[model samples]
Target chain A: MHEEPLVRWDWIGRNWPNIQVLLEDHVVMSLVPIVVGLLVALPLGLACVRWRWLYQPTVGVMNVVYSLPSLAVFIVLIPVTGLATRTTVMIPLTFYAMAVLIPAVVDGLTAVPDHVRQSAVAMGFTPLRRLLRVELPIAVPVVLAGLRVAAVSSISLVSVGALVGRGGLGYLFIDGWQRQFYTPIIVGIVLVVLLAAVADMLLVLAQRLLTPWSRARGSA
Target chain B: MVAGEGVGVNWLIDFFGDPANWSGPDGIPVRLLEHLQFSALSLLLAVLIALPLGLWIGHTGKGALFAVLSANAARALPTLGLLVLIVLLMGVGTDIPVLIPLVALAVPPILVNTYEGIRGVDPELRDAAYGMGLRGGQVLGRVLVPVALPLILLGLRIAAIQVVSTATVAAYVGLGGLGRFIIDGLATKDFPRTIGGAVLVALLALAVQLGFTFIQRLVVSPGVSERQAVR
Candidate 1:
C-alpha cells in the first residue's frame, strides 16, 4: 500500500493537456461566481446601511441559506434550473458568496469611522463621491478580507459541482474515486489547495496595495 | 385530472410515504443514525484533542499563530477531496477514511475557539485568581474555563454543524450515511430520493445549529452571556 508514489510523473507527462483543462475549468468555475456575487452583494450591503431594519432580518434569512449544506443547494436547484449547465453551479455559489460577503461588506462599510465620513462631507463630497472615494477606500481591507473568504469557499465548492457532472477539479475527484486512481485524487487536492492559497495570497497582496494606510496603522 | 407529475412533489411524497424506506438496512433512520454516528464521533475526538491544546496555548498566551493558521487551512480544504484522499490512502473497506476527514474538518473550529476563548480571559481575573492562592490548574479551571465557555461553545456549535452537514460525504465512499440517497439517487436517475436526501441533510444541519444555539443560551453564564451579547 505504501509502495506507490503519491504522484505519477508518467501520467502527467502523458496527460498534461487534460490536467491543464481541469485546472483551467476549476479556476474559471471558481472565479465567475465570485465576480457575480460581488456585484450583487455591494449594492445589497449598501442598502442595508441605508435601511437599518433591513439588516437583521436579511442577514437572518441569508444565514439560513448559508447553513444549508452546499450539496443540498446544488441538488435542490436541479428542480428549478435543470442540470449539467454552468448555471446550476453558478446560481448556488453566487448565493453562498453573497451570504458571506454581504455581511462583510456591511460590516466593512459600517466600520468606516464617522469622522472619516464627516471629513469627506466637510470637503464637499457628495453622497456618491463619499461612498466611492472615502468610505470604500477605507473599507477596502475589511471588504477584501470578506472577498478572500468568499473566493476560497467558492473554489472549494466548485468541486461539489462534480455531483452533477459539472465540477471542475471536482471531476477529478469523482472520476478518480470511480476508477480508483490515486494520482488524480492527489493531483486534484494539491491543485485545489494551491489554487486556494494562491488566490488568498493575491487577495492579501491586493489588500496591502489598496490600503497602504491599513498597513501603516497596523505597524504603529 | 392528471394523477401524477414529473420528478417533483408526488415523487417526494411517495418517497417519504413508503414504510419500507423507513425500516430497512438502507432506510432513512438507519442512514440518519450512520450520519449522526460519524458526526458525533468525529466531534468527540476533535474536542478531546483541541480543547486541551487550545486551553494550554491560551493559558500560556502562546500559539495564536498556530490557531489562526490551522483555522484558515481547514476552511480551505475541500471536504469531498479530503474524504476521498484519506479513503484512497487508507485503502477503504472501513469507516476510518470518513472519520479521519470529519475529525480534520471538526478540529480547527474547536481548537481556534478554545485558544481564543482562553486567551480572551481578562488579565485581571488571572491575577486575581493567583492572588487568591490558586495554582495554575485551579486558575484555569475555576476562572478561565467559565469565562471562556461562551466562545468554546460557539466553536463546538460551528464544528458540530459542519461535521453534521459534511458527514453526508461518507455515502460517496460506499459507506452508508445520509448522503447515500443523493449519490445513489442521482446515479440511478431517482430524482425524488435525491431531493429527499438533500432536504434531510439540510434539516439536520439547521436543527443542529438551533440545538447548539439553545444549549449556548442555557449553559453560558448570564454575566458572560450578557457581555457576549453586547459584543
Candidate 2:
C-alpha cells in the first residue's frame, strides 16, 4: 500500500517569511518603474497636448505600449537587463503604464470645456499661470483616471515580473506552479488580488483629494 | 533609460544568431511563419467564439453574474495553470493556449459592453417597443442592441487591442508568433533583437487600434458620434 500527500500546510506555514521577502522585492521593483514612468509620461502628455501636433505620435506610442503583452516585453528586456532586478522587471512596466497615462492625461486636458480656456486668457492670466490654475485643475480628473489605469495595469504587470526572477507575490504563483504546489499558488493569487484592490482604493483616495468635485459625483 | 549600451547591443546580436539554427522541416521563414499562423489562428478563434457568445450572453441578462465571474477569473488565472491542466488532458504544444486565452481574453469586454449596453437601454424605448407588440427577441434586436451597439463596440475596441497584444504569450509553449523573436532574444541574451520584437508587437497593437477605430465607425450603428451627446 502507498500513501500520497497533497496538502502542504506545514511547508506553506514555514515559508511565510520567504513569501514576504518576495513580496517586498516585487513591490520595490513595481513601484520604482511606475513612479519613473509617471515622471516621464505626464510631462510628455502635457507638452504633447499643448503642441497639438505631437498628440498623434505621442498617443500612437501609448496605444502600441498598451497592446504588447507584459510577458513579451519582459522577454525582450531580459536579453539586455539579464535575469535579475528592476532593469529586467521594471523598465517594461513603466513603458506599459505610459500608454495608460498619456492618453488619460490628454483626454483629461481635452475634456476641459473650450470656453474655460478662452476665459482664462481673457482674464489676462499668463500662460504659465493659466495652465497651473485653470487647464491643469480641470485636467486633474482625467490625469487621475489615467493614473488609476496605471495602478491597475502595474499591479497586473508585477505578476509578470515574477517570470523574470524579480520577486513579488508573483513569485509565489510562479514558484508554486513550477512545483505544482496549489497552496502557495492560492496564497499568491489572494495576495495579488488584495494588493490590486488596495492599490485601487489608494488611487481612489488620491483622486478624491485631487478633485473635490468628484466626491459629489462619485457614489462610492 | 539606457537606450544604448554594451550589454544591450551584445544581447541583440546573440538573439538574432540564436534563431540562425532554428530552421524548420521545410525552409527559411518556416518557424516565423508557423508562429504567425498560431497567433492569427488564436485571434480568429477568440473573435469567432467570444464575440457571438458575448453578444448572446449580453442580451440574455440571465448569465451576467457568471460572465463577470468567469472574466475576472480568466484575467487572474495563470496561463501556466491552464497549460498544465491541458497537458494532463492531452499532451501540450500549441493549440490549446491559442484557444483557451482567446475566450478568456475576449470574454470580459464582450460581456461588459453587452450587459452595460442592454441594461443601459432607455426604459422608454423598451416601453415603446412593448406597446408596438414586439416580442422579447424583437425588442432586444431592434432597440436594445442598436442603442448598446456603440458601447459594445467600445468593448470590442478594448478587446481587439488586448487580444492582439496577448496572443504573443503563445510563445511560452513554443507556439509561434513575434514572441518567438523575443524568446529567442532572451535565451541568447540579446537586447537589440528583443527590443526589435517589443517594437514590432507595440506597432502591431497601434495598427490594430487605428484599424479597429475605423471599423467601429463603419460598423457601429450610424450616428454613434451623435450618441456622445448623451454623455
Candidate 3:
C-alpha cells in the first residue's frame, strides 16, 4: 500500500466548496446556541438568584445535563427533532450552553458586593435600572469568563454532531476516516481548533471592552 | 409525528426488555464493561500524568500560566476530531487511538483543578507547616494535599464524568463499548438500539457523578468540606 501524505493540498482545493458550507453550518449551529442560551439563561439565572434555594437545584440539573455526552444527547433527540436537522443539533447545544452559562450568570450577579447594590439603590436607581446599569455590567467579566469556556466548548462539540449527520467540521472527520484519508481529518481538526481560539479571543476582547474598570485583573 | 413518537418509545422499551441484548459478546454487560475499561484506563493515565505535574506546579508555584493556558487549550480541542485524527495517523487496530483522545479530554479538568486547589490553600497554614519543621515534600503531602483534597476530588469527579461520557466515541472507531450500540445502530438504522445505548451512557455518566459525590463525602475532611461550604 502506498503511504498517503498527511495532507493533500489538491484534495483541499477540489473540496473547498463543500468544506466552506460545512464551516458555515458549524459556525451557525455553534453560535445560535450561545446567543439563545444567554437569552434563556439570563431570566433563569435571575429566577435562581431571586429564589436562593432554586440556585442549587438548577445547578444540580445543569450539571447532570452537562455530564451527559453530546453524542448521546444528539441521538436521543432524534425522535422529536429527527436526524441531520439543525434543530436536533442546536437544541442540545443550547442546553449545554445554558448548563455552563447559568452558573456563570448567577456567580456574576452574586459577585456584585452588597455596598454596590446599596449604593445603586441609594442613588435612586430602581431595581430594574440597577440590574441593567449596575449589576449586569459588573457581571460582565465573570460572565465573559464563563462565556469563553462555553463558546470554546460549544465550537469543539459542534463537530460531534456529525455522528447524527449535522456535525459541521465533524463531517470531515467522518469523511476522512471512512475513506482512510487524512486530509479532511487534518483540515477538520485545524479548523475546529482555529474556530475555538478565534471565539475565545473575541470573548476576551468583548470583556475588555465591556469591563474597562477591571483591566487590572489578569486573564483566567 | 405522534404515532412515530409512540413507536420510538416502544422500540426503546423493547430494546431494553429483550433478554438477547443481555447476553453474548455484544451484550449490554460486555459493552458496559468495555466502556468502563476505556474510561478507567484513560482516567488512570491522565491522573498519573496530570496529578504529579499539577502537584509540582502547585507546590512550587512555577509554570502556573502554562498550566492554565494548556488546560484551556485542551478544553478547546474537539474530542471527535482528535480521535479521528489519531486513528487516521496511527491506523487503528489497537486501543491506543481511542485512549489518547479520552486521556486528553480527562487531563485538563484534573490538572487545572489540582493546581488551583493547591494554589488556593492558605499561606498561613503553609507557614505553620514549615514552622513545625516540615520539609517541602512533607508540607505538600501532609498539609497541602489534605487541605486541597476537596478541589482535587472535584477535579477527579469532573474528569471521570467527562471520560465516561466521551468514551462512547470509542465505538465510532470500531472499538466495543456502549457506544457500539449507538454507532452501529445508527449505521444500521436501528433507532431502538441507538436510543437504548444513549440512555445507558447517560445513566452511566450520572452514576459516575453520584459515585464521585459519595467519594468526595467519604474522602474530604469535614473541616475542609465545611470551610468550602461556608465559602
Model 1 per-residue lDDT tens digits across residues A115-197: 98999999999999999989989888888988998999899888888888788888888877888788888788888989999
List the lowest-lDDT window of 10 residues for candidate 1 chain B: B1-10
CAPRI class of candidate 1:
medium
Which residue pairs overlap in candidate 1's backbone? none
DockQ of 1: 0.51
Task: Give the DockQ of candidate 2.
Answer: 0.24
| Docking level of model 3 | medium
Report the error of model 3 at residue A185, Å: 0.5
Off by over 4 Å in 2: A1-7, A114-137, A216-220, B1-22, B25-98, B114-154, B157-167, B173-231
lDDT of 2 by residue, B24-118 (tens): 54222664466446556655665666666666776666787876666555554444334333332344554664556555666676667667777
Please report, in order, the local distance difference test score of every candidate based on alpha carbons: 0.86, 0.67, 0.90
Among all candidates shown, the one with the greatest TM-score: 3
Residue A9 displacement in candidate 3 (angstroms): 1.3
Tell me the deviation in Å of residue A70 in model 3: 1.0
DockQ of each: 0.51, 0.24, 0.75
Instruction: Give the candidates in order of lDDT, highest first.
Output: 3, 1, 2
Q: Over 4 Å off in model 3, which ranges?
A: A216-220, B1-4
The alpha-carbon interface RMSD of model 1 comes to 3.3
